[model samples]
Target: MSDLAITLLAGGVGGAKAAEGLAASVYADSTHIIGNIADDDEFHGLWVSPDIDTLIYSLGDQIDRQQGWGRKNESHQVLNELEKLGQETWMTLGDLDLATHIFRTELRKQGVRPSHIVHRLAKRHGITMPILLPTDDVIQTRVKTNLGALSFQEYFVRERCQPTVNAVEYEGASIAKATSESLSQIEKSDVILLAPSNPIVSIGAILAVPGIKDAIEKSNAYVIAVSPLIGGKTIKGPADKMLTSMGKTNDSKGVYECYAGLLNGFVIDDQDSMDATWLETQGVDVLVTPTLMSSTAEKAQLLSKVIEFALAHRNVRAA
Candidate 1:
């Protein structure tokens, strides 16, 4: 098998799960990620990057598995006190996790670009995989729903995804440019994996960055994606609803259509076998297997399969 230089596009939860599996199955030095920044926000005057923090904590084996985000064994004393003082405490900032926010915010205030700050944060957590944002510029995703265009956190977390999303737009994508690191990673990648992240919130936001889509389309790498939806439902989050609400197909097929010319291969669950076969005729190579990540062993198994698929398909070496 040819050694691979892999680039992952991801957000939190499902992305983290697939990341964990991939981390276990590959040389850490060979994998890099373009992390999702859609859910970033400020709380208590500090910057909180929820998805990036989730990646850091998970890679460091310190994630609260039950909650799926935040540090393991988190202390909420600070949040409790804030609530007692009648502060807006919709977002909980844990004691140890607070340190990250404080450090990142301070760095930002000191003119540290977000990309540099992210690298520093990842290093502090001993994360081996090189991860960067699509850009250092602020590009918040805004969900336009019945409630109007709200920041991603406001739409998803604050409203609990209760409102109907009529459209979603990246607030600053019109002039957003991909960082040199992101462009370089795409150029050198042998295999690019889009993890099973929320399509609308995570993947969509990444693609919204102006030149990144064109880069992926023109890259020499075999770009493959694991569908976030399985069995006509999202494994988590609002991808299914968002797809249907937009008058688009809401299954793995919908995901294939979303990627269009960029994806050379699509990995769907065995349950979506029919969709996989149909997508094959559309010219996307299909890999079907169990995509669930209930435990470390199961995750490893799926990762092993994905790696094998990437390698075998690498024979074609996408142009």
Candidate 2:
């Protein structure tokens, strides 16, 4: 029954877990998620928004918990057929999951905005919380490696993120405008959370959009981020490897540095307590907790601590 309206910036499995936690909390109705669209791409003439759909499926409780993406009980018949036809099926879209992409592509063809499509998709999945896109424009993540620049999907899925990371870029972010809904949500929120997604590709791409970072910087809300790294490594994805490859520390302290000026506080795993004192020296409040959201109860527990931490900062900011 709290009055706080939370707007979360998120992407990938970690992001979904954070969103799941908040969706199960008392502030569920007041939570709005702004998801990354930079990881989006086309597969077989159908627009595939991986990060956005991950949020939708996860929040809808239809996600494949084992794979951490796509739908539960999904069939890959379509992908199998495509492979049989000599199509490069590295992306691996299940039959049921392809339906979402087809629907989204059709809507886009008919001139529907991406945000509106996401709203409809969420509603169809019985998700009550809002899922917002950072922009309606095409902003994609491009990874530059020694092998050459690859699309985020190519680097992530095709090569299995094995490329030696040289640089990461959001292709259209320099000119892309932030969606009105996303900016307004940030302004209206009492608390803003940066989910424990891949900072370089997921959260980084969101911030790369022209006005989103400015909106966060100017917001009066308490901004907090959860570190995806636990003891200098990620449970999923190549975030830790990317961080290290890009000349950044692969720990909670590095996560804080990534969002340095924007955050009022940071949530790290209890095992990373060693870095707490140094983080405090940099003038950011640190909250060390068990950030691994392995179970439903654990997700809720982590979010409960995060909420409490945010409330404390909100009070101080208000005072």
Give the candidate number with the greatest TM-score.
2
Off by over 4 Å in 2: none
The parts of candidate 1 lying over 4 Å away from their true place are: 1-3, 317-319
User: Per-candidate TM vs. native?
Assistant: 0.95, 0.98
Q: What is the lDDT of candidate 2?
A: 0.91
Residue 76 alpha-carbon offset, candidate 2, angstroms = 1.3
Give the whole-model CA lDDT for all candidates, comma-separated.
Answer: 0.84, 0.91
C-alpha RMSD of each candidate structure in angstroms = 1.7, 0.9
Query: Mind giving the per-residue lDDT tens digits that candidate 2 earns over 33-150?
Result: 9999999999899999998999999989899999899899999888988899999999989988999999999999999999999999999999998999989999999999989999
Candidate 1 TM-score versus the reference:
0.95
Q: Write the per-residue lDDT of candidate 1 for residues 1-319, one digit (tens) a residue.
A: 2366888899888888878887887445678889888678888899899889898899889999988888988899998999999998777789999999999999999998899998888888888788789987778888889978888888777888888889888887888878999998888888888989887789878888878888887887888999987798876688888888777888887888778878878899988898866898888788999898989888878877886787678786632
Q: For model 2, name the residue pairs that clash.
A: none
Model 2, position 91, has a per-residue lDDT of 95
